[model samples]
Target: MNDYIIRATAGNGAIRAFAATTKNTVEKARSLHNTSPVATAALGRLLTAAAMMGIMLKGEKDLLTLQIRGDGPLQGMVVSADSNAKVKGYVFNPYVEVPDKYEGKLDVSAAIGHGNLSVIKDIGLKEPYSGQIELISGEIAEDLTYYFAKSEQTPSAIGLGVLIDTDITVMAAGGFIIQLMPDASDEIAEKLEEKINRTPYVTSLLDMGYTPEDILKLILGDFDIEINEKKEVEFYCNCTRERVEKALISLGKEELEKIIEEDKKAQLHCHFCNKEYNFTENDLKEILKNAL
Candidate 1:
């Protein structure tokens, strides 16, 4: 099924919520980076969370970047999302596979280890706003929940999950974020917590062919969840050969000349998408002219 995200409000707007199905989205990252099963889960959860966060933007160009620097084999994970629900991301070590933690499930926590979670929000401002918090459990979901509560001062519950098949392909991937509004009452918060705790994993629901709305219903159950908007989400990178050429130009005339005189050709690879752009000596000369 195609991936999509939904924004909703429950309990008469006392709770703001977002949910998404990201199987295809996450699969794209897996194919691009060739991430191992554990890496896939770690990166997939971040991408899913970033997608939901992206919809919260107030402007078209606003962006949210989620970065996790851990001490595990995965090292780190980076994900970026724009208001349009376009998301892209990669893991520092996509091929690092670790054994399952319990009951033979993907060991996301061990793969992530303990580190810091930093969120940078760029809203076309002079300086972007950033929030940082220590990882609570190295589990992306729990760490994000802690971040929202401590860093953003927003009480939230986050549940992110990615199910990987034996062949390393993603079987399912999705997540949900439920945040308490400023006027949320204690009773409402308790009930919401109870509902969320009892809800099934987001990926499991998606595996059952559940739509974004159905997933919301499953979480909000008896609560009044009003669907606000729905948007399609995908794994997209905004890198281009021209952009790469401009970067090479920024390397200055000396650097360009050195590359042309030595290698005669330079290969630039985009870390985001793993796409390589090759520049011949003539290309370097042209870039040198522009650099001057």
Candidate 2:
């Protein structure tokens, strides 16, 4: 698979690890959103993390959403994923630009500024699980590491990166999520941390022709690592015209009447995919007839 995730365990199940290569998935999002380089990096990082986290869900229909609401130029981002690794997301200000912190690196922290990261998981339950954390760092990876440690009480190391080409297209994008399972020993955890500290940036490894499997091997090669599952992930949105029609219907009879009277037609846009659904006057009238 071109873009895929690998799930593995090591240290006799004392550690759980997930690695993914999401260049194509992120490129599709860049083309769809026309995101600037900084915006692309930030969104790509979150999308990659979301894909890995989504796969952690047990149920086929389980959903995960990662949202960052910040005070910087890139106002916020919202990414949603399913257990099967289908993910979609959007940035509030795709064109927002910021100066690089260094000569080459994109300043994702500046783009995101201070923010709150919210993780919402909708499993097959009456109410979805939600957790919120003040972002320790606006860099998507660190914030998520903090999220895992604080909210889930799982010590995790997350590394995410997005490399932008000269022409403003995605060159490489991917990440790894390493967690210390409850049974993990201090020696194993320390060794894993040391390995991560010595490891190169995920994008650098990916650009050097490393696959997800290779990444895990490099990080946990000595831990008796065993691969459990592998799955392809994509930038997918499940929005349809029928679903859009249902949304319009939910706008209420009076609201639909007002829209019909004023505009003579209606146009709705899907935030996740930038798809526009248009309804002519007749279409609006027909929809109004079915309004609740």
Candidate 3:
């Protein structure tokens, strides 16, 4: 119940919502990638839809990534988020093992088969505004609702989930993202697509303890809400050790002198939080004298 995120607006604003519950930020990313219950329900539904699309960034060092490369056997995933929803990710086969798309469901679109779903963003951009598509149902919320209706043309309705618990942890992660505001009409987008086709699986209403403003008032309860902001999402990982010694001195000086002549000592790990960054051999000769 602590992980948060909420930002609202209803018919009066022609719908623009976002919700989140993220069971302790996907149980701290399934305890830092010990993932399995289907890679913790496919990286906990893309980390609860990148923490509600990272508070729908608008600066404050905005950033959002969300890659998913696919081709099955869980060969993809790489979330990131900021604008205060703080996230992190990893899972290019976190114990890949595909099976159940039936009895008790956990196939995450067959462990993410077909590929692509990149959506960069980066805001203080001098370039960062990428977008890609394809995976219409590798199922990270319908490839982010077809990447927000073809890469941000908006008109969306995403609902991710993540339940897994018979010991594998994360009892319920969360999600919801309902957009439609270009003077939304057409009878309020056909009554929010017939009340999100009759609600229910946002991790089964966060396992019945629903929050994120009660799942946006159970799907915009007759469009009258207008909350706006609440944020407090987590599982952050701003990796450090002085940002991995400035990324090993930006890999210059001949790749830090061939990692001090063939791995004299350099650990590096951080796939978003597997943490491990030990660089000895005098810390690669003081990071190659700060890379010359």
Best TM-score goes to which candidate? Answer: 2
> What TM-score does candidate 3 get on C-alpha atoms?
0.37
**Per-residue lDDT for 28-142 in model 3, tens only?**
8888888888888888789888878878888889888899898898889899988899888988888887778887788888888898889898898589989998897797897
What are the per-residue Cα lDDT tens digits for candidate 2 across 221-258? 99999999999999999999999999998889999999
Model 1, 1-292: lDDT tens digits are 6899999998998999898989999999999999999899999999999999998989999999999999999999899999989999999999997878877478898998889999999999999999999998998888988998898789998888888887889888888898999899999989988988788876668668777788889878778889999899999999998899889888878888888999999999988788989888888887788778
Cα error of candidate 1 at position 60, Å: 0.5
Which prediction has more favorable TM-score, 1 or 2?
Answer: 2
- lDDT at 158, model 2: 91
Better of 1 and 3 by lDDT: 1
lDDT of 2: 0.94
Q: Which lDDT values do the candidates have, in the order given?
A: 0.90, 0.94, 0.86
